[model samples]
Target: MSLIVRVAARGDGITADGRHAASAAPGDTLTDTGEVIPGPHHQPPPCRHFPECGGCQLQHLDDDSYAAFVADRIATALAAQGIEADLRPTALSPPRTRRRATLHAEGGLIGFTEQASHRIVDMRECHVLHPALFVLVGPLRALVQRLRPKGRVELHLTLADQGVDLLVKATLPPGLAAAEAITAFAQAHALARLSIDEGYGPEARWEPQPVTVTLGGTPVALPSAAFLQATAEGEAALVAAVREATAGAATVADLFAGLGTFALALPAKVYAAEGARDAHLALKAASAQRPLFTEHRDLFRRPLTVAELDRFDAIVLDPPRAGAREQIAKIEAAKTPRLAYVSCNPSSFARDAKALCEGGWRLDWVQPVGQFRWSTHVELAARFSR
Candidate 1:
């Protein structure tokens, strides 16, 4: 028998003697013929849809092993770039804490899609969704049957300041009669807002009040289409890390600042730049009372040049999965003293980190944030100084 040494970046288990085993955790025993025997680090998955549901991947790993997985992912990525830092303890968000999610609907069923397939799981019970969000699953199932959505439909559910904000995107446009049914569903569910997209854009069908998401003690108007961190706990951890990384900087630049997640949280005179019109407008309106400036600039097309990058004491970048390749190159050229980078993709982040380190910047530390609990998807905040 061989011992499962570690979990791979793609959620598979690797044995010491060069073998991959599915559904096996660290410390598990692997038989010669490929039977996985659970060990100390292995535990029963909390969700009934384990190994089938695509929403979560590491549910079988205990908390300790799961935290190790989060840390190891970052370590592995940094190692590839010939870089290392003070890897801090990983912050694991508790189960049932996810406040924002995208669920699929088909054939009167509502749930996450299956792993590596187009099929839906038709979730009967979920362990990762918050109590408030999961409460509407049954109602949503019935509503889908009534609406009879043609083709695949996507339901974007987010917990706004008022209540659950739901956006339904379906192939069939809502007719006048369907509008009535949608309104009724929204009202019955006490939803904060509801919108529908028919390939055009999201049009609000029901909104009793303007939906806003409170960040940094200010309520920023959450546009129908906006991005937010997966879980509140994860957001808190990331915010704390960024704040610590950029502490004492009087002037800061928040690039790709979606709804001022890090810009508003920092007390410095922040110059927040965002590409999306709604997000830029919302951040401008929300931070009118604070020492913050807003700019609707697309970093991908036109990154801040070295001359422009030298205007801040520190910069905070929270780029998308693609990472901020262009911005990092500018940073390399500029004389910016420090920066705190928040990234959702480790491989992309590692590439950026390599450039930063090669440019004479020092990687101080890294803090991993596993917001999507039991999932292989990882996020982190890091500090770099020159």
Candidate 2:
């Protein structure tokens, strides 16, 4: 049996918009009070769903508040590990700049899963998607409505430089004719690019061709499967932050350099290391000044040793959410001269930053970049010097 709990106004660690910690009450069910209204220094609520959706927890927080939260989170994490530094809030992105998304579609209807529920919510207007995506929502919905598949569906959209990429996934009934219907619907509606992934249907291999996205008027074409910043404006700001962090460094190492994003623009000779084969190929294609070397190694599994650190004067690491515990250990043992760590996971970054500090590296600055807007997620660029 579920119990209902009425929020008792706002209190410590709670917000004016009724966001509170979950506690068990006698018999009252929790009353959802709409989307959360973001507080000061936070990003505005982009979606009507707001805090309810697992997708974005920081939506109700306004841009300024959100930026502060990000910085503070990192600072708190670092403090726990005895690393102190000045943390700066980076720029936030404009609303609705999501270039790509993977929405869950079920019962032939395209939608997102409800918060913490397998049940789907029919999304009418997604405020975080690109403007071009907003324009295609009605038609896209209608197309899905027409081809009602049996089970769940996955809709992936990518706004490349030239056009949009739509990849639809579903389990089909024994006799559903989705390919022709989907193709006709796309053609009639003038969809930029439509692909289908019917795990068990006749037209199973339909895939959209990749396209380019011009950022700040600079054409950056990436594969659809490649990692991309959620927001264009946020990406530009991050690029600027990376440039600022690496400015004047003669030689730098970009660990886990996906597509050589920072490496391409940096003044230093970057020794880029990436784990993904596709990312390495993408970096090779994107980078102009062939880095001193590009190596394919899983830094997470087999980390760089202190001997490796002796080679580069400076190091910039951008590892995934799991954090770079192994790599950080090696860096510390090596006593690398300078270190710049870019991270998306605050908790992990905090832990790693502490290790660096204990190893005699000073935390110069922690810059928080709001790359994933309207979400609890934050991207950070932390500089540490020996």
Candidate 3:
């Protein structure tokens, strides 16, 4: 028997004897025939879908092991880039806390795709999705089965302030009967907004009132496909880290700010820059009388130049998964006194952190966030100062 030492980025636990066992957790033992024997770190997976569902990967690990895995993922990435800092304890969101999710539906099944495969798991029970979101899965399956959607349908659900905001994407446009049927489902569920994308752009069929998501106490208009932090607790943790990272700053620039998540939270005057038009306009509409300012700018194509970056007392960055390579280059060259970098991809973050450190900025500390609980995906907020 071989003992599992640590979990890898792909959710496989590596044993001390250099063996990779699937669905194994740290402290677990692996037999010669690749059978996993549960150990101290292993826990019974709550969901019946276990190793099949792609929504989660490390459900077999206990909370302690899961938190360790989260920190290790970040530490490994930082080490790869020869960067080091104070790695704080991982902040884990509890089960049923996923406020937003994208699920798949085909034939009469609805759930996340099977691990590394196109097949659907047909989820009957979910442990990660918020109760408000999970309650609609069965109804959605029945609705899709009735609609008999040609091939596959994508369901995007987000719990908004009003209610559930649902977006459905199907192969072909819905006919009159199908449209009416979908409208009935929306009404029955009391959905905040229901939009359908049938090859073309989203067209709202039933929207009694505007949908908004409250971020940092400000209700910003919720775009159909707007991005949101996976869980509220995770968002709180990140927001807290960011607030700590850029504390006491009077002027701040929020790069890649989506609907002013960090911009509205900061007490100082904030310049919120976003790429999406709907998000920018929504933020503009909501910023009335607030110190926060909104600008429609794509930092990827046109990053803030060094001179413009130098104007801010501190900067808050929440770039996409690809990381802000272009923007980071400019921030490295700028004379900004402080920065709070919130990242979803540790590799890209480590790469950018290395650049900043090489450019004379001190890598102060990092706070890891496991918003995608029980999954290998890790996020973090880091502070850098000169």
Candidate lDDT (C-alpha), each? 0.93, 0.66, 0.93
TM-score of each: 0.98, 0.80, 0.98
lDDT of 3 by residue, 103-156 (tens): 999988899999899999999999999999999999999999888877899999
Model 3 poorest 10 in a row by lDDT? 171-180
Give the Cα error of residue 30 in candidate 1, in Å.
Answer: 0.6
Q: Candidate 1 overall Cα lDDT vs. reference?
A: 0.93
- Write model 2 residue lDDT over 76-124, tens digit each, in one string: 6777777678877666777788777778765544556765678766677
Put down candidate 1 lDDT per residue, 81-153, tens digits, no spaces.
8988899999999999999999999898789999998899999999999988999999998888887878888
**Count of clashes, each model:** 0, 23, 0
What is the lDDT, from 0 to 100, of the residue 47 in candidate 1?
83
Cα displacement (angstroms), candidate 3, residue 114, comes to 0.2
Return the lDDT, model 1, position 365: 94
Deviation from native of the Cα of residue 145 in model 3, angstroms: 1.2
Query: Which candidate model has the greater lDDT, 1 or 2?
Result: 1
Runs with alpha carbons beyond 4 Å of true place in candidate 3: 172-174
